[model samples]
Target: MSIKLPDSVPLHRGLIREFHDIRVSDVSSSFVSCQKEIYDTLMFFLESGIDYEDLCPLVKSNCDTYIQLLEQEEESQGFQTKFKTIKENYKEMTESCEVFDLDTMDRYAERDITAPQLSKLLKEANDGYIPKIKISITMVDRILRAFPYIWKDPKCILPDSLLGDGFNNDANEDEIEMAGGSIELTCPITTLIYEEPMISKKCQHTFDKSGLTEYLKNSDTNRYMEKDCAKDGCSKKISMDDFSPDTIMSLRCKIYQIKRNENNNNMKLEALDVL
Candidate 1:
């Protein structure tokens, strides 16, 4: 709420442009990383000989039914192909920002208002007003929804008359889906390593700084409400006002990068020695 902005409309325009660019980068990365994480998870399950499909149906039984989804994407030539991995398709989706209308947001006001807000701001660089799509409350919500599914087990994918959990009496614990996973030291929200980290004053939990800022700024209902900590099980209130730059975490992250590189080099050296 205490966002400081220069009154120059030209500056606001630059700021707004920067906001949109950063958002596209953030959102595109989220789309790729979330799918990549989920892909790795399922691949891990398959390699471990786990029957992921039987254990964790995309939908749980006793829930509302919906159509099952599988990747049926057509390539540039309009030929659907499975030769490319699912991760590659996710990358293709990111180029379009997953089919989201960022420009429509470029004109958004509050989510509750239906009118486009872009034209409301001065186009002549005479006022400091920033467009709502430039800040994108929609993006904040989209990122929030996209990241969580990476860790959740696919609910029963197709809940037809034959496959409902209630109808399937043979399902067992070994076949049931598990929650969350480990993928190195990555942000829970982005599923990537930390960049521009911020520590939550309330819970001491850390999140990518840009992600946290957006989360605090947007409300799904466009009404004031407190946000809980982003950590999976933590419930402490998180506010934009309570964040502090984390220099220690920054230094520690550098150390992590160096160590990871060193270990990678060592593995390469050992492989060469064997040859």
Candidate 2:
């Protein structure tokens, strides 16, 4: 008796064909499994949410592997091609990313709008004058308040940090207050306001205008008045003839007349001593 076998059992020439089909099917299944594993691994590293610097090398390696796998599967039909296409699309999307731009100032330069190229741009901008600047209401109000006290330079723009402090490139807000004697003397850049100028009397010793005037009037000696500015640019000479009686009296009285009237004796004695 020949060996008996079920219909499912391979026999003679058909057996080899059956074995070849089984082998091909198993190889195809294993290739699908390998491709799925590689895809999953690449996706895990890509989506790891790590810093770009740390992930860059891993991403490059994964991409190289993916490209190689795609080349290998060029003859294959269906799923592999679809996955490779998805990855290529993803690479295109990711590699096109960009960073946002920010505005910053270079303090070393005197002007924000600088020489040559920048000057040309500014000229062009001013010619058209679109006024593209954006500012908040609070900033406008603050600048408006400063406008009366602060003098602006023709070519300079003041930063917000410099405002509240005195802004002439010298002295802080507190020093300005001290010099003005607790008042902020706001004035246009070109004008001079009255702070007493130093004067020397005919006696030849120097005193401030107020000190000299008080000495002249209260003292019985009747010394003459003279104005002198020690500075190189100014050579103004003051005399009693050039000034009014009230100006003379104001210069002589250390206290304003209103204050002197209330405490006349002390100021009168001080005024008398210069004689």
Candidate 3:
């Protein structure tokens, strides 16, 4: 069942802009605060009449980093490339629905992996005294969470969503039934309803486990050669190890089976009533 979100592009574009605004402007602003903190630390040391000559390098180093950042914003090719590449990625997310999925969610989380990289940058700007950056990818996180309805096969509930006005909440399980969007029960390879389905990790296509394994074994390949996936139109090189039991698909099949049985019983009772 698909729900078309009316006018989703503007909201999505806004979210992307907000994310980059945090990444670029907020982080850039934090650099100034960071520099002040460094100076304040040095001032604290000097007022105590302590020998802080070794720490003077940190001030110059921090200033250099701040200036380098300004220069990058002005004309650095390296910075331009980085900015362009990330902007292109965001552009795709705003304009295309093809990339939203579990794998991309994993990647989004990986992008904000830790404070270590920021700490390392601060250390590079100094001589390893700083251990933090007062920044997080909060806007990016919000953008990713805001578009659950856009996912091709949504696997989890988003913590939050945007465009509450655009969503038709009635586009639910009952909508799927009313639209005759029956769940696929049969395996493409075996033409049999699933008993235990195994899915290809790379392509997300499912097939009958034993039938797929046997077909792959008999394909045009030897011991060293990996067989192309048996699923029609898919060319992903695959082996038995590449397939795994899909619990969610299995659960869907079970639900389909139960619903089908109930429907058949209702038809039988109606036939008896007609007599």
Error of 1 at 222 (Å): 9.7
Model 2 misplacement above 4 A: 1-26, 75-275
**Whole-model alpha-carbon lDDT for candidate 2:** 0.36
Question: What is the alpha-carbon lDDT of model 3 when measured against the actual structure?
Answer: 0.47
Whole-model lDDT per candidate: 0.41, 0.36, 0.47
Measured with C-alpha atoms, the lDDT of residue 232 in candidate 1 is: 73
lDDT of 3 by residue, 154-248 (tens): 22322313313323334432322121333465787788877788977666667787677666774555333357776666778887777888544
Rank the models by TM-score, top first: 3, 1, 2
For residues 1-275, could you state the per-residue lDDT of candidate 2 as single tens digits?
A: 65322222112343435423421112345545655665566446434544434544664665456445544443343333433444444334423422111221221132332222323333554455232222222322333323222212111233444243322324222222222233222111212322353323322222344544553443565666454533223355755444322221122222122232435665677889976
Better of 1 and 2 by TM-score: 1
Candidate 1 stretches with Cα past 4 Å from truth are 1-184, 219-225
User: Distance from true position, residue 252, model 1, in Å?
Assistant: 1.8
- Candidate number achieving the greatest TM-score relative to the actual structure: 3
Selected candidate, larger TM-score, 2 vs 3: 3
Query: Which segments of candidate 3 are over 4 A away from where they belong?
Result: 1-183, 219-225
